[model samples]
Target: MWVPVGSMFSFIEVLPLVLLILDAMEHHSLIRKQQRFR
Candidate 1:
């Protein structure tokens, strides 16, 4: 399988962005749950 080097670098960059978005969504959900419980 052949992959472009530029695409590999872009994927690496986007991977962290995706993770950050997921982490932010999880954090927001947790905050909402805590606020509802309070």
Candidate 2:
């Protein structure tokens, strides 16, 4: 393969961190939505 395996592995390593950040952002938006209705 022309692509390096290390870069592919690095993306796998960073995947959870990216997901965690997305999850936090979604949670924060949901909280703000709840506050708006109150």
Candidate 3:
């Protein structure tokens, strides 16, 4: 299957934001768990 350049470019641009969001979520969850243990 052939993909359009614009679509591919957009996906690449958005990938980092998505990864950052996921990393932030994981960090938040870790903090919450640590607080609960106290």
Candidate 4:
């Protein structure tokens, strides 16, 4: 029981970092597109 709960807690901790990385990547792509248009 404790093992599964511990894994779930770790997953929750990592979720935000993953989301942040995805958001950064999206922003980077947008910047690239804007630069291309210029």
Best by TM-score: 4
Predicted structure 3: clash tally: 0
Off by over 4 Å in 2: 1-3
lDDT of 3: 0.95
Which residue ranges in model 3 land beyond 4 Å of their true spot? 1-3
Instruction: Give the TM-score of each candidate.
Output: 0.82, 0.83, 0.88, 0.97
Expressed as tens digits, the lDDT of each residue in 4-37 for candidate 4 is 9999999999999999999999999999999999
- What count of clashes does model 1 give? 0
Instruction: Name the candidate, 3 or 4, with the larger lDDT value.
Output: 4
Higher-ranked by TM-score: 1 or 2:
2
Model 3: per-residue Cα lDDT at residue 13: 100
User: How would you encode candidate 1's per-residue C-alpha lDDT over 10-34 as one tens digit per residue?
Assistant: 9999999999999999999999999
* Model 2 root mean square deviation, Cα atoms: 1.8
Candidate 1, residue 36: CA error in Å? 0.4
Residue 2 miss distance in model 4 (angstroms): 0.4
Q: Give the alpha-carbon lDDT of every model.
A: 0.94, 0.95, 0.95, 0.99
- Checking candidate 3 for backbone clashes, the offending pairs are none
| Winner of 1 and 4 under lDDT | 4
lDDT of 3 by residue, 1-38 (tens): 34688889999999999999999999999999999999
